[model samples]
Target: MPRPRTGRRVRTLLAAALTTLAPLVFLTGPAQAAPAAAGAWTPAPAPVVSHVETDDPVVFITIDDGWATEEAAGARQLLLERRIPASLFLLPDAYERDRDYYRTLLAHGPSRIENHTTTHPDLTTLTEAGQRAEICGARDRQLAAFGDGPRLLRPAGGATYNWPYHNADTRTAAPACGAEAIVMWTHDLTTWGSWTPPTPELKAGDIVLLHMGPTLEADLTRALEAADAAGLSPAPLRDYLLG
Candidate 1:
């Protein structure tokens, strides 16, 4: 009877020992989580800033329309002198009138060309198919003209109607047409026709809008000066868009 009792006690101790050792085995080699799927690229959602912002002291200069040749010349010269990168939103038809002129600007390393639409129609008034044609068609035309596709789209009048019968406005359709973003004016200096420069004090990440004709040089110069005062440098629009 004493031997039987001792044997039972021995069995109990062995069971306890196995239980403790089993936990140690698990602790020594932890399981690894599975690796992310191969070739999977998850992109973040587009940012909602009116103009992209960075901690760096940089601004974006965006010119709209291909209307004023005189202003375009002045703007190009000023931008080159300042060593600043600028973006142009051109009307495809307007550009077709003088492709070489726009191409000359595009040849500059700091400048990028994008779309303003085919004929500059108010996109909010058109139908869905019409909207697509204007938005996507403008991109196609721009790509054909510049050899580089447009990554940004600016709608005419910056308006979007809510009715389903009418096409979504340029503001709404720009993203739909595969534009990395839409551009709107933060400052309008009336440089093309009036030649008046806007007041200084423009801050970093500001998107200053100007036109092509005669007063472009003065307007751009004023804007640039104001930006400098605000401690901001000009950044190319391409930096913010997908290549």
Candidate 2:
């Protein structure tokens, strides 16, 4: 042995070994983490659907907004009594005013409350962030109140046509806000004041649109009758949409 190794010499040798290994330690750390970092992904936008193509004898009923307390009672009664699984796309304020109304419908019937935004705004006109706020804000409120989150989003405002006002941003924001589909309609039967829009001959996989107001009860009745005439029954929209 060349002179018993001094403590200082031993320390120096150990330091050199450690320095040589340090680059590998740093490199391995990042290499191990790279997979996880690369796995991160953003969700794709939800699809807009005006109709579902199916051969089953089924129709989808969707009601929008939550206003018209007295007028809505008849509709509520019909829904509960008939056990129609209508998708209620409601505004936050509408249900907040009378949570019990929706709660009871959900408790007793096959109906479910879905999202129509906090304030009904033309989603096509809103910025991406603004549209997200409206869509996600409604989802949060509904989840808090009902212990259930809305899976479908119906963009607000459509006139003389079935599809609601929406844009590319609406589709992108909808999925980000937890909506699976941006629901449009094949038939809009909303009645305004004394004017009742004519009902179309119902068909399988048709999406029927109605509103909560003075004519809801009548509209619901007519829709059911039309569905019956077409040999279609009202089916749960969520199940059909997902399937």
Candidate 3:
């Protein structure tokens, strides 16, 4: 004979059914809000530019480090006289001794100060946080000294060897520090010691690298002459890069 359904049996069955359906109901019904992702989101890395690709008849002049300014008076005059829109990747310590020198360069011409890190350390050797401090710290100091923030970063070292030393961290750290591009050089025209590097035929989008040294004036002249030969005029790097 079949057993009749009892109240207890009914109650137990109902409870079991509720237990089985509860999870499904919970899952299908309006979902509970999830916790937000951890950590603040950072922006994508800025582009690394060794040279600009453009059709304009223009070249870029970049002078690294603010040291040797005393011997670079002629170079300074050339920058002002020609209104060259040179990107000055100056260190804080480099300009601390002669704020007026850089000040005059920025005040009179289209030249603008860019970041070269606070201590001029090879950024590839640093952690992301260390690189950020070096880059962002330099920016803060530059803003204080020049009354304008830097838009470009030229990482310390790499020019002499014609190879840029930057890792993934450098690209990320630069944007975090407000840099739009990691500017390297297409041609290093800087005069080291008694040796003057041969000036290649300047292309329309070539980036020339010079340093503030005893030969900066001569270096600038060589670069300008090369540009003239190639029918390229010096243009503002910042404008071109942003555009």
- lDDT (CA) per prediction: 0.62, 0.77, 0.78
Model 1 clash pairs? 68-213, 71-213, 71-214
Error of 2 at 153 (Å): 0.3
RMSD of candidate 2 to the truth, in angstroms, is 18.4
Per-prediction TM-score to the true structure, in the order listed:
0.70, 0.80, 0.82
**Candidate with more favorable, higher lDDT: 1 or 3:** 3
How close is each model in CA RMSD to the real structure?
20.3, 18.4, 18.8
Q: What is the per-residue lDDT of model 1 for residues 1-243, given as tens digits with 9 covering 90 to 100?
A: 122344335434643453344322211111122233354321211222244545668888888777757436767777777767778888887788788777777676478888777767666677645776887888888777777877776666633423211122332345556565555555776543434654857766667777776777777778777887898888986675443
Q: Cα deviation in Å at residue 64, candidate 1? A: 0.6
lDDT of 1 at 111: 83
lDDT of 2: 0.77
Ranking by lDDT: 3, 2, 1
For lDDT, candidate 1 versus 2, the one ahead is 2
As a TM-score, model 3 comes out at 0.82
User: 2 or 3, which is superior by lDDT?
Assistant: 3
State the lDDT at 83 in candidate 1.
68
Strongest candidate by lDDT: 3
